[model samples]
Target: MTSGRDRLIEAATRLLTESPDREPSNRELCDAAGVAAPSLYHHFGTKEGLLDAVVDRAFGAYLKRKRGMLRTGDLVADFAAGWDLHIEFGVQNPVLYALMYGTRATSSAARTADDRLRKALHGLRDAGLLRIDVDTAAAMTTAMAVGCVTQLNRERRRADDPFATAMRSTLLETVTGLPASPSEPEFAARALVAHLEATSEGFTAPERALFQQWLRTIADTTRTVQDGQHQ
Candidate 1:
């Protein structure tokens, strides 16, 4: 059996997102959550707390799907995966999505999500894959993503559709300066890694090991001169 807190969150997420047209009353939430009014109050303290939890639960779900994907050390691919996951979440949970984002007010959850995205953008900058600074890249990518999600909500289109995929691809290429065609930097890096692995490049064993290390440093772009510029 789900805990009261969990049930409340689940119920709120479903009710709010499934029918933005209808506001769920406390009585409705209590019924849907299978909890008494006292239980809701005891768990959340108040209606505001319950609403906040609903928003948190919504974003938490998005991040959960994003984390499920494997990390290939391919920044571009990782970004694309994250983008797809974001769209999927918005499409699947339009009511929850609109509640969280339709307003211009930035909640703690929204800032947290943006910070997470900024970290990914910074990784791309470190990889030499970005034409702009990490902050600019993060902002541009985020703005585009928000715009796309808002459109998806109103247009009522599945994120899996070709139109959504094209928007993702076009925006990614435009912001990161990565190729919309082939020869993306990540692909080149992977190809180079394979070549070095196969030929050993006429270097000593230790040298080849260090060479791989260098490649990782470049791809990771983790430690840069101005890494402090971003969080």
Candidate 2:
């Protein structure tokens, strides 16, 4: 049997995710989780705490799935696998994503969850998994995944349809800088790692002064490129 705290978190996640208009009241959360009102207060202290717990659970699931697929094999293949997992999660748990990203609750738990994801991505960058520069690459990848899922959610399409196939292809191509074919390896993972290491080592200060400078340069260049595309 799940513990009361676990049940509370699970219940809060469901309530918060499914409620589109406003935050659920504590009483509503208690009913959803099958816990008594005092049990909710005893475990979380307040509704905010319950929300934090929910976010933690959601992000925990996301990181667990992300880390599980990382292997020392081909980085490109690993990336594709990771992306697939992300899309899968987005589809399966739209409510979780909506709650995590949409809610305006203030709890240390929520910040902790957000920080955990950032640190995981940072480690991936340090290990040479993702591109070092953060122009729109990270944001764009998120956008694509969320956008694809959003469309599917709106259309109420089956998961095993052409839309999913095409969205996965598009995401893989855009994020990895590779073609959507099985035969070609983009080497983006390798290049990203090398770029991050070089940028880090070239820094004159341990505070990452040089790396920050380089990132700014890249960000500016990326913006110019994007503007040109618009023009």
Q: Compared with the true structure, what per-residue lDDT tens digits does model 1 show for residues 40-65?
A: 89998986788887887777666665
lDDT, candidate 2, 5-38, per-residue tens: 9888877776656675577888888888788889
lDDT measured at residue 180 in model 1 versus the true structure, 0 to 100: 52
What is the total number of backbone clashes in candidate 1? Answer: 2
Off by over 4 Å in 2: 14-22, 32-38, 70-72, 104-132, 183-231
TM-score of every candidate relative to the true structure:
0.69, 0.59
Clashes of 2: 1
